[model samples]
Target: MKNNLTSQQMGKIKNLFADRVRFNKVERLVYSHDMGMMPEQVRALIQCTPDAIVQPISTQEVINIIKIAQEEKIPIVPRGAGSAGFGGSVPAKAGIVIDFVRMNKIIDIDKEDMTATVESGVVWQNLEGELSKRGLTLRTYPSSSDSTVGGWVAQGGNGYGGYEYGDFRQNIVSVDVVLPTGELKSFSGSEIDKVYSLCGITGLM
Candidate 1:
């Protein structure tokens, strides 16, 4: 598949997300593999050396990279911190490994509505320190200081507080994702009734 990538095509993909994204030697060395826990065969696979590490600064950059990866039929693996105990971050195929750590930004907070817009890399521990002052929390939170909101959500995580605040899946207000085909989309949040009505219809029904 890589053989089909013309010089021009390669340049385009590189530039598509170049503003804050990058392709570098150091990136290859670090993100080429994931940090998987011991005693699992899965660890061998996630350690595949990616040809490139794509750091998307925004949702749009994510979409652009996915589009080109799709064109090249490159395996696009999404990743955050090296915290997937299941070794999901291990890329079996050498392709594009997207690191979302740089996208960490708190876009907005609506105290009246009790909602906050944040980038995927917002650490669970960091979120707690900020939200605690407002008498609120992520509802579902990973105990680890380095755990990211997106990584936890992708794994459908649950916390000890699940019985009250709900599990990781339930606590999420929404998610903006770039599909493998390069579609930028969001679920929940403003798509809902614009209020935190826990008892109301799930809006999914």
Candidate 2:
């Protein structure tokens, strides 16, 4: 793996994320793969190893990261739990890997509406436990209990409850996303179709 970020750019990221940034080769290598095993030929062709790994605790931090990546023309790969085996979380090129683990806060749960508002890093199992305490549970969830809500949503949302409740999209109410251009926007209803399963191409949810 090669270091693609300049010293000044690294400083800017350090300023934003403080001690949450990882630059060591070992650490970056850990982020290069997900649950799935890629073929040797494919692995040999791509630079899966990231230049750096950063954990952001808020949406604003994600926006700032996007700004920096845009300015430097670097690839930004968003990751959550790294439970998916489809290689969506891994970087195809060496760049920044934004790990959302630190953002795993359940913002709100509307009991009456049967809806939950959470950060992208919210793990499904944790959310299920919280909901169970309130005498509620998710209608559908991924087979991987450790999968993040945002990850599952981004990966096409078909899982344990697909037979009854359908895919996650049918249950989605809305989403707040930071677009590639650093614009924050909310989408719901039919508009959500634009952002679902886009793998962060359209925006970061």
TM-scores, in order shown? 0.76, 0.97
Largest lDDT belongs to which candidate?
Answer: 2
Clashing pairs in 1: 46-90
Which 10 consecutive residues of model 2 have the lowest summed lDDT?
152-161
Please, what are the lDDT tens digits per residue for candidate 2 over residues 135-189? Answer: 9999999889898888876777688878999999998999999999999999999
After superposition, the stretches of candidate 2 with alpha carbons farther than 4 Å from their true spots are: none
Runs in model 1 with CA error above 4 Å? 1-10, 19-26, 38-47, 189-205
Best by TM-score: 2
Error (Å) of candidate 2 at residue 145 is 1.1
For model 2, state the Cα shift of residue 54 in Å: 0.6
